[model samples]
Target: MEYVLVLYIEQALKKGVVQTMEMGLAEMGRVLRQRVLLIVLVTLLAVGLAGAGSFLVLEPEYEATTTLLVQSKQTEKGIAYNDLLTDQKLVTTYGEIFQSRMIAEAVIERLGLDLTEQELLENVRVRSSSESLLTAVTVTDHDPKQAVTIANAMAAVFMENLGRIMQVDNVSILDTAKLTSDVLEPVRPKPYLNMAVALVLGAMAGAGLALLLAFLNNTVQTEAEAEQLLQLPALGAIPFFEQKGSSGYRVVVRQDPRSAVAEAFRTLRTNIQYDEAGKHVKVLIVTSTLAGEGKSMVLANLAVTMAQAGKRVLLIDGDLRKPTLHHVFHLGGQIGLTEVLCEGVAPEEVILPSAAGPDVIPAGAIPANPSELLGSPKLRGLLSDLRIRYDLVLIDSPPLLPVTDGQVLSTLCDGVLFVVRSGEVARDQLQQAKGLLERVGAQVIGAVLNGKQRKRSEPAYSYYAAPEGDPHD
Candidate 1:
C-alpha cells in the first residue's frame, strides 16, 4: 500500500510539471503574438547590419589549396599492402609537418613576404584522410594570387624537408595550387549564412525582451486578473468600441441599442437586479481606482439601461470636482447636486429630464470643498429621499485613491460597483481601492471590466435570423 501511494504521488508530480510547462509555453506564445512587430523589426535590423558588415566592413579572404601524394619507392615487389597502409599512416604525420613553423618560415622567406612564422601559420591549414595516401595544404590571404603563391611554396618547402627529416623521397606533388581568371572567388564573408544567423539570434533576443516586458507589466489586463486581484465577482465584460466622427460621452445603450457594448450594459443590469445580495440595493456608487477609467460613462449607460427595463432610475453626477454626467446627457449643469446640497435649492427644481430615459442631476458648479459637501448630512438626506422616489439611484463618484469623496459616498450607498479598465489600472491600485472601500465598511457588490480587448476570432453577440416556417409549407 505504501508503494502504491508513492507511485500515485509520483504521477501527480509528473502531471504538475507537465501542466507548468504547458502554461509557460502558452504565456510565451501570447507574448510572441503581442510583440511580433518588435521581433520582426529587430530581425530586419540585424539582417541589415549583417549585410553591411559582410559587404562593406569586413575584408574578403581568398583560399588556395595544394595536394601531395605519399607512396613507397618501386622495388622488385611493386608495393606491399602493408607498405601502402604505412604510407597512408605517414600522410597524416606529413600534414602536421606541412603546417609546422619551419615550413611556414621557409615559404615566407622564399616568397619575400613580410610576416612572422606564426602569422603565416595562422593563415595555413592542412588536411589528410586516414584511408588515402594524400595530404592537402591550403593557405588563405587577402589577395587571390598571394594565397596561391603561399600554398605552392609551402608544399615545395615541405617536400624538400621531407627527405632530410624522414630520409624518404617517396612524396610527389599531386596537384599544385593555381588561380584561374574565373576561379578567384573569395571564400570568406559568406553574406547569406551570416544574415541567416543574425536573423535567428535577433529574433531570440527580441522574444526574450518581450517576455521580460510582459513580466514587468503589473496592469490588470483581463477580467480574471481583476477578479483575482480585487477579490470581486466580475459582473460583466464591456468590449471596447469606437464611434467615428463623434466626441464626448456616449450612451451606447440609448443610441445603438443592439451593439455589443449595449448588450454588455444590459447584462450588467441583469446581474445587479438578480444578484442575491444586491437585489435590494437601491443606491449604488460607481467608481474606480483612478480618473479617466470610463466610470462615469459606465454609470450613465447603466442608468439608461435600467430605465429602459421599465424601472425608474435616477442618475446623479456625484463627482462634483469633475462632473461629466451633464455633458454626457447634454443637460444644463447650472444648478444640480451642489445647489441642492449647499444652496438649499429644491431637488425637484434642479432635477432635469434627459432624452436617454432617466432623471439626470449634473454636478452644477465646481466647489472649493467637494469632500466636505459629499459627507454633509444634507447629501445623505437627499439620497434617502431619492431612494423612496426612484427604484434605483446610481451615483458617479470620483476615484477612491485620489480623494475621499468616493469613500465618503460609499458609506451612504447600499452597494458599490467598481469599474476597472483593462490595461489601465494596476493590480496594486485595485487592491488599494478595495482596501479603502472595505475600511469604510462599504458593500462592494461586483465589478465591471471595461474596455476589454476582444479578439477577431471570438464570435460576436448578434441576433441571427430565424428560419422561416418550413419550406414544405
Candidate 2:
C-alpha cells in the first residue's frame, strides 16, 4: 500500500511538472507575439552595429599560404611500400619542423623582419594532408605583402635546415606563397556574415528581454486583469484617442456621434446604466489611482452621454486642487465649487448649462485645503441637493492615491467608479486605491479601463461623423 501511494505521488508530480512547463511555454509565445516589433527593432539595430564594427572598427587580416612536398632520398626507381609509409610519417614530422623556433628565427633573419621567434611562430601554422606526403604552411598578418613574405621565408628556411636537422634531404618546395590585394573583401572581417549572425543573436536576446519585462510588469493592461486584480467588474474599456489639432479633450458624443470613440462612450454609458447598482447610482464619484489618467475626460463624456440619453445630468468638478471641468465646459473656474461650499453660494446660481446636454459646476477656486473642504458637511448637503434636482450627478474628483479628497468624497456618493489607465497605473497602486476605498466603507460598483489602444486589424470609425441625409426626408 505504501509503495503504491509513493508511485501515485511520483506520477502526480510528473504531471504537475509537465503542466507547468506547458504553461510557461504558452506565456513565452504570447510575449513573443506581443513584442514582435520591439524584437525586430532591436535585431536591426544590432545588425547595423555589427556591420559598422566589421567594416570600420575592426582591423583586417590577410593570410598567405605555401605548400611543401615530403619525399624519400632513396635513388632507386622502384619504390617499396615501406618507403611510402616512411614518407607519410615524415610528412607530419616536417610539418612540426616548419613551426619550430629554429625555423622562425632563421626566417626572421632572412627576411630582415623585426619580430621575436615566438611572435613570428605565432603567425605560422603547419598541417599535413591525411592521404598525401604534402604539408601546408600558412602565415597571417595585417599587411598582405608581409604575410606573403613571411610564408615564403618560413618555407625556404625550413627547406635549408630540414636536411641537417633530420639527416635527410627529402623536402622540396611544391608551391610559392601568393598575395592578393582585394580591398572589397577582407579575410578577417566579413561584414555581411557578421551582420547576419548578429541579426539572429540580437533577435533572440531582444525576445528574451521583452519576455522578462512583460513578466515583471505588474500592471492592469486588459479588462480581465483589472477585474481579476481589483475584484471589480470592468464597466468599459475606453479606447485611446489622439488629441491633436482642434480636438482637445474629445466630447465624442457632440463632435462625432457615429465614430468609434463616441460609440465607446455610449457603450460605457449603457453599461453604467444597466449594472447592478445603476438605478441607485444617482451621485457617483469618478476618480483614478493616479493623475493624468484621463479620468476627468471620462467623467465629462459619461455625463454628456447620460444627458444626451434624456437624463438630466449635473457634472461637478470636485477636484478643487487642479480642476478641469471649468475649462472643459468653458465656464468660469474661479468661483465654482469653492464659492458654493465656503461662501454659501446657491447651487442653481453656479450651475453652467452647455450644448453638450450636461449642466456643469466647475471648481471655482484653488483652495489651500481641498481635502478639508471636500470633507465638510456643507459639501455633502450640496451633493444631496444636486442629487435631488438632477437625474444623475457625476462628480469628477482628484486622483485617489495622490490626495485624500477622492477617498473622503467617495463616502458621500452612491458608488465610486474607479478609473485605471491601461498600461499606466501599476497593479500595486491600483490595489492601494481599492484598499483605501474599502477602508472608508466606500461602495465601488465597477471600474473603467481608460486609454486602451485599438488593434490595427480592428475596424475603425474615425471618419464616420454622421449620416449624409436625414432619414425622415
For each candidate in turn, the TM-score is 0.80, 0.83
lDDT by residue (305-400, candidate 1, tens digit) is: 999999999999999988888888888889989999889999998889998899988889899999999999999999989999999999999999
Superposition error at 109 for model 1 (Å): 5.0
Best by lDDT: 1
> How far in Å is the alpha carbon of 13 misplaced in model 1?
23
Candidate 2 ranges with C-alpha deviation above 4 Å: 1-37, 58-60, 75-93, 129-132, 179-186, 216-218, 242-250, 462-473
The digit string of per-residue lDDT tens for model 2 on 22-131 reads: 33776677668778899999999999999999989999988888888887766667777788898999888888887778888888888888999998888877889757
| Location of the lowest summed lDDT over 10 successive residues in candidate 1 | 14-23
**Please, what is the whole-model Cα lDDT of each candidate in the order they appear?**
0.86, 0.83
